[model samples]
Target: MQLLEYISFLLLSSVKFFFFYPVFITKEDYNFLEAMTFGLTAGFIGSSTFIFFGDVMYQFFHRLALKKAITHPPKEKKQRSIKHRRLIVKLRDDYGLWGIAFLAPILITIPLACILATRFYHNKGKILGHFMIAIAFWSALIYIFKSSLIHLIS
Candidate 1:
């Protein structure tokens, strides 16, 4: 049950965001292997699903936005969107997909990363593959370090 909870949490939270949960669970359950397994599996599955879904939703919303713009031209200021677009453009210009892939697992939530990646990159599979690799690497490193720290403390 605890393992289920941990995986479910990882599914919703970013791999980095909930990376320490496994440590806590290990402390309580003394099941480092199980916790690590759940965490890693959850990170992979959750991030993959999120990335794919984000791509689909982005396409849908993009089409919807175009249609809306064509039919009902808005007069409202898109300050927030403009700001976000600028930020994304800056990130794209500065770092590109590799940077986003490397940083996403640790620096940002998976869904947000997926959305950004999808917006910038045309290859969904490639982006998702990079995200999975990042997640796996981070999950393993975090689990090892945290579990070892817990062991040392105990």
Candidate 2:
């Protein structure tokens, strides 16, 4: 029952973000190796699913939109808010796809980052590699700091 709980927690966490796994596993009394493995697995599975399947969803929606356009015709493009436009432009111009990939696992949800990466880059391998590096780095950092902190407090 405890193992099942831990597995379910990690699976859900991977779909959410990589940042919380170290803290979560430590709290659950898992060792460093178990924490690292579970954290990485969660991140990899979530991101990989989005990277491959997300594009298929995107195309399906895009084609749907195209078909709708043919039947209904198009309207004037809606004016996007300046803030929204600026943020998109900034991400594209300054950060680009790599920046999103590097920050996605930590800052945003794994699936979101994967979707953004899929949208920008056609090379799934490159995005996956970068995500793996980011996940490893974050998982180690979280585990080390969180474990040390726990010891200090206890």
Candidate 3:
């Protein structure tokens, strides 16, 4: 029964890791490391999926919506200034994959990354690789901080 309970906890943690971080961590039963792992994994997977297949998924949904004749309210168009374009180009040239992976999750979303990858380079593998690297860096930072906090408290 204890083993069953542990398995149930792990499963729940994994699912929570894939969807929401704060929700998983708020569970009183989960220890620090368990919660961190769940949060990191969830963030990684969510970010990766957004970076790799976001555009395709968006298109699929868009097509479905069109078929269903569901009208999306039109969005206001924001003009991109020359400076903004220059900044984007600089980021693309300087950071390449790593820049996009790191900044996208912070500034945009994985889906936006996917759109950028497809629209700019048309390379899904490269986008995924960059996103995973970014995830690794972010996860490591989170893990270290969490461990330090636990150590300090204990």
Instruction: Give the best candidate by TM-score.
Output: 2
- Residue 39 of candidate 1: its Cα lDDT? 56
Candidate numbers, best TM-score first, in rank order: 2, 1, 3
| Residue lDDT tens for model 2, 20-111 | 57557867777889878877888888878888898887788899999999999867766676677677568867987767766776777888
- Between prediction 2 and prediction 3, the one with superior TM-score is 2
Candidate 3's C-alpha lDDT?
0.59
* Candidates ranked by lDDT: 2, 1, 3
Off by over 4 Å in 2: 18-20, 60-82
Off by over 4 Å in 3: 1-23, 26-40, 57-83, 150-154
For every model shown, what is its TM-score relative to the native structure? Answer: 0.67, 0.78, 0.56
Per-residue accuracy of model 3 over 45-154 as CA lDDT, tens digit each: 56556556667787898798787665665365346766777887787899876777687545655556656666666666777667667655654555566567767988
Instruction: Tell me the whole-model lDDT of each prediction, alpha carbons only.
Output: 0.70, 0.78, 0.59
Window of ten residues with lowest summed lDDT in model 2: 14-23
Where does the lowest 10-residue lDDT sum fall in candidate 1?
Answer: 14-23
Residue 71, model 1, lDDT: 100
Cα lDDT tens digits, model 1, 1-154, are 9778655565554544455555455555635576556555666665677677887878888999999999999999779999988987888889888777777766666667778887778787898778767666666676777768867998
Name the best candidate (by lDDT).
2
Model 2 score (lDDT):
0.78
